[model samples]
Structures are given as structure tokens and as C-alpha cells.
Target: MNVVEMLQEEKVVAVLRRLPSETFLDVVRALAEGGVRAIEVTMDAPDGAELIRRTREVLGDRVLLGAGTVFTREQMQAAKEAGATFFVSPHLDSDLMHAAREWGVPMVPGVLTPTEVAAALRLGAEAVKIFPGSLVGPGYLRDLRGPFKDLKAMVTGGVNEDNARAFLDAGAVAVGVGSSLFPRTDLEARDFASITKRAERLVRAVRG
Candidate 1:
């Protein structure tokens, strides 16, 4: 399937941000074990490119790997070289959009206002991401759909198992879940089982 189709099918993208490198793979494995097929490792993580490369090598085709929080051409290029099939950024940028096109990688750039959404589409973003999804809630997506019915939007930030399905029902193609999926205390305690259970719960909530 195409990137967008795969994302819609997965219904969830487990986003890992600045996680402890030592347990990175463990966390990924746990998520995948819980049936999450799409995963994103944010660029802010230490040695992010290498981590992407390693995850691709280790996970093979079992998971769809993506690079998140991308804002520059350099970051996009590095992520592409490191085997990221898709790129996601918190904001729209022309340079990064063009790079993703040239490299033949799908990019999902964040957009808030209707004007920003139009700009992102014109810039060739494969999909638009609504960051700080908490600010507007699922109702906002429903409102956007009234005008941009064909728009593929991924909701991120402040997402949790409780509201994941609501976002999808409101027109979100998928949701990017971060800290809610990997609680800090659980990570510190190496409670991978808990992470797995959370992942499973989210998958059920969104995909049901």
C-alpha cells in the first residue's frame, strides 16, 4: 500500500520522542508486539538518524518507520538516508517539502489554520498533521472536513487512548500518540509490558 493508505489503515503512529536510547528498540518492539505497525522516532532524539537506521535494519518490514519533528532540508535528507520512508514535521516549510519530493519520501507537515492547510497542500505535503490536537479537539477536524473533505489529517499532541477513536471518527486519518503511550514512570521502570498493554489498548480504541 501507499504511505497514506498504510497510515490510514494503521490508524495509529506511536511517536517516540527523546526516549532513552538504551531502551529505544525495546520500546519499539513492545509497541509492535501490541500490533502497532506504524512508528515514528522524532529528530530531537540523540543519534536519531542512527536509531532510525538500526530500527529499519532490525525490524525489517514488520514495521513502517518514519522520522518526526522534521523542520529542515538537512534533517529530512538525513532521515531519508537513514531509511525513513516518511517524514513528519510540526510545521510547514517549503525547503523541507521540496526535499521530501525530490527524495521520493512522503511528508506530513503540521497545519492549524485553513490558510496553512492550503499552503501545505500547495507545497506537496502528502498529508497535513494537526499538532497540539488538544487545543481544538476532534470537533475542529469535523469542521475542517466540511470544507476539505478529501484532506488527510493526522492528529498529534495530547492524544491518549480515551480520545484516539474520537479523532478518527472526526476525520483524522490517524493519530500520533507520544508520551501517553509511553509513560515516563513506566519507561524509567523498564515496564515494557505496561507499554505493550497501552499500545494494544490504543490500537483497539482507534481501530475498532
Candidate 2:
């Protein structure tokens, strides 16, 4: 399946930021073992592009890989070349969205208001990610749907097992979970088991 189809199927995007290259595969393994099928490696992470490439080689088509924190058209193209199946950003950028469309990569651009969401959709984005989702809560999603009923919104930031279900129940297509799902301290301790447990909990929350 393509990235868009995969996102629709999984309904969750596990964002990995600040993860060491050495532990990247281990993290992917833990999440995959816990039934998580989509993962995003942020460009801010060390060797993020290389990690994405390696992950594609290691997991093949079993997992959907994406690049996050992409800020420019060049970065989007590079990510695609590095085997990123999708693109994500913390803010909506028309240029980046256009590049993603040109590459045929599923784009999930961040938006904080109805105007931005409309702009993103106009650019052909498959979905819009609501950043700082904690602040707005699921209620914001419900409100946005009122104006853009056709928009597919994913809530990120401060999304944890405690409130993941709330976001989904509120009508979000998916949620981009970061530190709450992939804690850096725990991973550094080589606690792959803990990561697996967290992933499992998140899976349950999203499913619920």
C-alpha cells in the first residue's frame, strides 16, 4: 500500500525525535512488535535521513516510514530519496506541500487554524496535523471539523496513552505521538521492553 493508504490503515504515526542512530532499529522493532505499523523519523534527530534509509532496508514493506520536521522543498525531496514514504511538518508550507505532491508522497502538514487547514488541503495534503494538540485538546478538533468537515486531522504534541483515545474519539484521523510513546531516557537505558510496553499501551488507546 502507499503512504496515504498506510496512514488510513494504521491511524497513528509514532514520531521519533532525538533518538540515537544505534538504537533506531531497536525502537522500530519494539513498535512493530507492539502492532504499530507507521513511524516518523524527524530530521532533527541524529542522522535522521540515514536512519530512514536504513529502516527502509531493514523493515522493507512491513512498516511505513516517514520523515518529520521537514521545512523545505529540498528536504522533502531528500527525504523521498532516502526512502521516506511520507512527509510531516510542524507548520504548513505551501512549497513543501507542493513538493510532496509532485513526488507523490503523502503529506501531513501542521495547522493551527481553519485558514491554515484550508490552505493545506488546497495544496493537496492528505491530512493536517494539529500541533500543540495538548493545548487545544480534542475539542479543537471537533470545532475544526465543523468548518472543514472533509479535512482529515491528526493530533500531535502531548498525546499520550492517557488521552490518545480522547483524540480519536473526538474525530481525529490519527495522532502523532512523540516522547510519550518513545521516551529518550528509557531508550538510552536499552529498555526495549519498556518501549514495547508503551507502544502496546498506545496501540490500545488508539484502538479504543
Candidate 3:
């Protein structure tokens, strides 16, 4: 399936940011077992490109692996080489959007206002990421749909099991869960089981 279809089917993208490289795959495995079909490893993570490569090698095509927090062409190139099928950014950048189009990689750039959302679409982005979803809440997403009814957005930042379905109901195709899906404490303690349970709850919440 295409990236957008993958996102629509999963309804959740487990955002991994600066996680320990050693156990990253283990975490991904747990998430998959819990029914998370889409995973995004932030570009800011240590050796993020290598992490994507390893994930593809180990997990194969069982999950939709993407690169998040992308900003520069170099990062995009590295991620593409590492087998990332799609990219996401926390903010909109015209150049980045253009690059993604030229390289034929699906990119979702973050936007919060009508202007940013319009700009992202004009710049050729197929989708947009509504960042800091907690700040504006699902109501804001509903409001955006009023003007951009066809908007394909993934709400990220501060997304959790309680609000995942709310965002989808508000017009988001999917939601990106970070700490809620992969809490620092759990990762530090190697609590993969807890992470898996969180993933299960989140997936159920969204799918319900």
C-alpha cells in the first residue's frame, strides 16, 4: 500500500525519538506485536539512518517504516538510502517539500495555522502533520477541516491513547504517539511489555 494508505490503515504512527539504538528494534517488535503497523524513527535520533536500515533488515516489510523530524536534504537522502519509504517534519519548509517531491518520497510537514497548511499544500506536500496536538486540541483540527476539507493530516506531539480516536474523529488520518507509546522510563527500564500494552491500548482506542 502507499504511505497515505498505510497511515490511514494504521491510524497511529509510533514516533521514536532519540531512543537507544541497541534496543530500538526490540521496541519496534513489541509495537508490531501490539498491532502498530506504522513506525517513525526521528532523524534526530543517534544514527537514525542506520536504525532505519537495521529495522528494514530485521522487520522486512511487515511494518511501514518512516523517517521523522526531517529538515534537510542531506537527512532525507540518508534516510532514503537507509530504506525509509516516507518522511515527516515537525515544521513546514518549502525546500524540504520540494526535495521530497523531486525524490519521490512521501513527506508530511507540520503545520498549525491555515496559512502554514495552505503553504504546505502549495509546496506540493501530499499531507501535513498537525504538531503539538495537545496545544490546539482536536477542536482545532475540526476547525481546519472547515477551510481545508480535503486535508490529509496526521496529528502528532502529545498524542496518547485517550485522545487518539478523538483526533481521528476530528479529521486526522492518523496520530503520532511519542512518549505515550515509548515512554522514557519504560525504555530505560527495558519494559518492552509495558510499551507493548500501551501500543495495544492506543491501537484499540484509534480503531474503535
Candidate 4:
């Protein structure tokens, strides 16, 4: 499905960062069982390329794989070859935005203010990701609604069950959950079921 369709349908993006290689497949499976399909595997991870490739091969179209923390053209290219059709970064770089457009890859560049949001839109970004969103809180998103009511926003950072719904209610089209969804304890214990339960709870909180 397209990014817009995926966002509207799933309303959540589980950000997997530097996840253990051994349990990567199981992690994805757990997330899927809870009805979360959009997954962003950080490119900066130790074995990102292999993970991306394997995720694509194993999940097929069952999940929408994205390359996150992607900043350079080389990184984007590597991710593309590894089966990531979409890209996400921590900052809004005009060049990176243009590069993604040229590559025909949907890139969600991060933004912290209205000016950056407008710049991203002009650069042809399909959507803008609000980084460190937890620090800014739901009010920040609510404030952006006036000038960017028509745009789609993804809140990444500091999102948990406590505030996932608040972010979505405020204006975020989708919320990206990292450590909150995949706790280190559960991962270490190979508690895939717990991961699935967490994902289910988060999904329900936002989309219910």
C-alpha cells in the first residue's frame, strides 16, 4: 500500500533501532500479530542492510519496511537495495528531501518548527516527522494544526501508551514507538508474546 494509505490504515510506526539480530524476525512477527505493520529499521543499526533484506524477504508485503535514521545518499541507496522503499531521517535536509524524490522513495524528514515544516513541504516531502515529539508534547502538535491542518504528521520519540493517543488526537497521523514498544527486558527474555501485547495496546489506544 501507499504511505498515505498505510498511515491511515495502521496509524502507527514501530521504530526498531539497533534491535538484536537473533530476535529481529521474531520482533517483527510479534508486532505484526498485534496488527502493527509499518516498521522502520534504523539504518545506523549494526546489521541494517542484512536486516532490511531479510525483513523484506521474510515478511514480503505483510509489513511496510522503512529505513530510518537515513541522512546520506549512500545510506539511502544502501537501504533501497536492501528492500526499503521508504526513508526517514532525524533532520530535515533539503538535499536529502530532493534525493528521496529523485529516487522515488517516500522520505519522512524530521522537523521541529513551522518553518522547517513548510520547507519540507516545498521540497516535495510526502510527510513530515516530528522528532523528539515527547519533549514537545501534544500541545506542540495542536499548535501546528492551524498552519498545517492539511498535512500529515508523524510523531517519533517519547511516545508510549500514556501519550500515544494524545499525539494522535492532537494531530499526528501516526506515532512511532521505539523502546516503549520493544522493551529490552522482553526482548532479552524472548518474550515475543509480550511484545505483541504491547503493540496491540498501543495500536488500540491510538486507533480505537
Candidate 5:
């Protein structure tokens, strides 16, 4: 399936930021073990391009690999070249979105307002990520859906097991979880088991 179809099927996107280059594969394995079928490797991570290439090689088709925190057309191209099937940005950038579309890669551009969402759709974005989702809460998502019922939105930031389902119920097509699902302290301590457990909990929350 294509990137957007894969994301819709998975219903959850596990976002990794600043993962240790050495342990990136191990982390991917742990997340996969916990039933996370999609992963986003943020550009901020060390050697992100090489990491994405390696991740694509290692994971193969078992997971849908995506690049996140993309802010420029160059970054988007790098990600696409590195074998990322999808591109996710923290904001709506016309250049970035258009590049992804032209390359036939799914793009999820971040937006905080109706105007931005409309602009992203107009630019041919596959989906729009509602960033810093914690600040606006599910109530904001519900309100947005009222007017843009066909809009595909993925809630990101400050999302945890407790609120994951709420966002989906609030009309989010999927949820992007970061530190809450992959805590830095836990990862630094090499607590893969804890991360696995947290991911399982989130899976249950979203599935329910």
C-alpha cells in the first residue's frame, strides 16, 4: 500500500526525536515488537539520512518508515532519497509540500488553524498534522472537524496512552506520539522493555 494508506491502516505513528545513532535499530526493533507498524525518524536525530537508509534496509517492509521535522525542500528531498515513504513537517511549507507531491511521496504538514489546513490541502498534502496538540486539546480538534469534516488530521505532541483514544474519538485519523511513548530518560537508561510496555499500552488505548 501507499504511505497514506499504510498510515490509515496503522492508526498510530511512533515519532522518534534525537535517538542515538548507535541504538536506532535496536529501538526500531523494540517498537516493532510492541506492534507499532509505522515509525517516524525526525531530521533532528543524528545522521538522520543514514539512519533512515539503514532503517529502511533493516526493517524492509515490516514497517512504514517516514521522515519528520522536515522544514525545507532540501530536507524533504534528502528524506525521499534516503528511502522514506512519507514526509512529515512541523509546519505548512508550500515548497516542501509541493516537492513531496511532485515526488509522489505522501506529506503530512503541520497546521494550527483552518487557514493553514486549507492551504495545506490546496497544496496537495495527504494529511495535516495538528501540532502541539496538548495545547489545544481534543476540544479544538472536534471544533475543527465540524467545518472540515473531510480533512485528515493526525494529532501530535503531548499525546499519551491516556489521551490517545480521545483524540481518535475526537476525529483524528491517527496520533503521532513522541517522548510519552518513547521517553528520553528511559531510552538513555536503555529501558527498551519499558518502552515496549508503553507502546503496548498505547496500542491498546488506540485500538479500544
Candidate 6:
């Protein structure tokens, strides 16, 4: 399936922002064990390209691998070659949009306003992500959908099991979750089971 179809099916993108390069595969395995199929390794992570390559190598088709925090063409190209099939950016950028289109990979660009959302769709985004979504809450997405009924919306930032359903109910096709689903304390303690459990809970929340 395509990224959009897969995303709508999975309903959650487990985002990793600061995962150590050494624990990449194990961490992903934990998530997958809990039934998460969409994983986004952000560019801010150390050796982002290598992590994307290794994530695909280890997980293969069991997961739909994605790249995040990408804002440039070079970053998008490298991640694409590393087997990334989708991407997310903190903001909309022309260069990044062009690269994803060129590679035939889906990109969900971040937007905070109707103008940005419209522009992102105009630029060919598979979907537009509402970043720092907690700032405006689910009502904002509901409002955005009022006028852009057909536009796909993905909610990101400050997302947790508690609030994910609100966003999904508000018209979000999917939600991007970070530290709440994969806490630093668990990772530091090497408690992948906690990550697995949390991922399962989050998956249920998003899917509900």
C-alpha cells in the first residue's frame, strides 16, 4: 500500500527524536512488537541516514519507515535512498516538497495556518501535518476541516494516548507521537518492554 493508505490504516506514526544510534533496531523492534507499523526516525537523531538504512534492513516490510524533521532536498534524497517511503517536516518548504515528489515518496508538511495548509496541498503534499497541535487543540483541526473537507490532516506534537483520540475524532487521519510513547526514562533504563506496552496503548488509542 502507499504511504497515505498505510498511514490511514496504521493511524499512528511513532516518532523518535533522540534515539541513540546503537539502540535503533531494538527500539523499533519493541514498537513493532506492540503492533506499530509506522516509524519515523527524525533527522535530528544521530546518523539519521544510517538509522533509516538500518531500520529498513532490520524491519524490512514489516514496518512502513519514514523520515521526519527533513527541511532540505539533500536530506530528503538521502533518506529516500535509505529506504524511507515517507517524510514529515516541521514546516513547509519548496525544496523538500520537490524532492519527495521527484522520489515519488509521500511527504506530510507541517502547517499552522489555513494559508500554509493550502500552500502545502498546492505543492503536492500527501497530507499536511498540524504541528504543535496541542497549542490549538483538536478544535482547530475541526475548524480547518470545515472549509477543506477533503484535505488530509495529521496531528503532531504534544500527542499522547489521552489526547490522540480527541484529534482523531476531530478529523485527523493519524497522529504523530513522540516522547510520551517512548519515554527517555524507559530507554535509559533499557526497559524496552515499557516502550512496547506504551506503543500498544497508543496504537489502541489512535485506532479507537
Best by TM-score: 1
Expressed as tens digits, the lDDT of each residue in 95-160 for candidate 5 is 787788788888999999999998988988768999989999999999999989887899999988
lDDT of 1 at 174: 95
lDDT of 3 by residue, 53-87 (tens): 99999889998999999989999999999999999
Whole-model lDDT values for every prediction: 0.91, 0.84, 0.91, 0.90, 0.86, 0.88
TM-score of each: 0.98, 0.94, 0.97, 0.97, 0.95, 0.96
lDDT of 1 by residue, 29-147 (tens): 99999999899989986588988998999898899899999877888788889989999999988888888888889989999999999999889776899988999999999998898
**Whole-model lDDT for model 5 versus the true structure?**
0.86
Order the candidates by TM-score, highest first.
1, 3, 4, 6, 5, 2
Clashes of 5: 0
Candidate 6, which ten residues in sequence have the lowest lDDT sum?
A: 16-25
Q: After superposition, how far is residue 9 of candidate 4 from its true place, in Å?
A: 1.5
Q: What's the true lDDT of residue 4 in model 4?
A: 65
Model 2, residue 142: C-alpha shift (Å): 0.6
Q: Write the per-residue lDDT of candidate 4 for residues 161-185, one digit (tens) a residue.
A: 8999998889888989999998889
Compute the lDDT of residue 87 as modeled in candidate 5: 89
Clashes of 2: 0
Residue pairs in clash, model 6? none
Q: Provide the lowest-lDDT 10-residue window in model 2.
A: 1-10
- Model 4 lDDT at residue 109: 94
Point out the higher-scoring one by lDDT: 1 or 2: 1
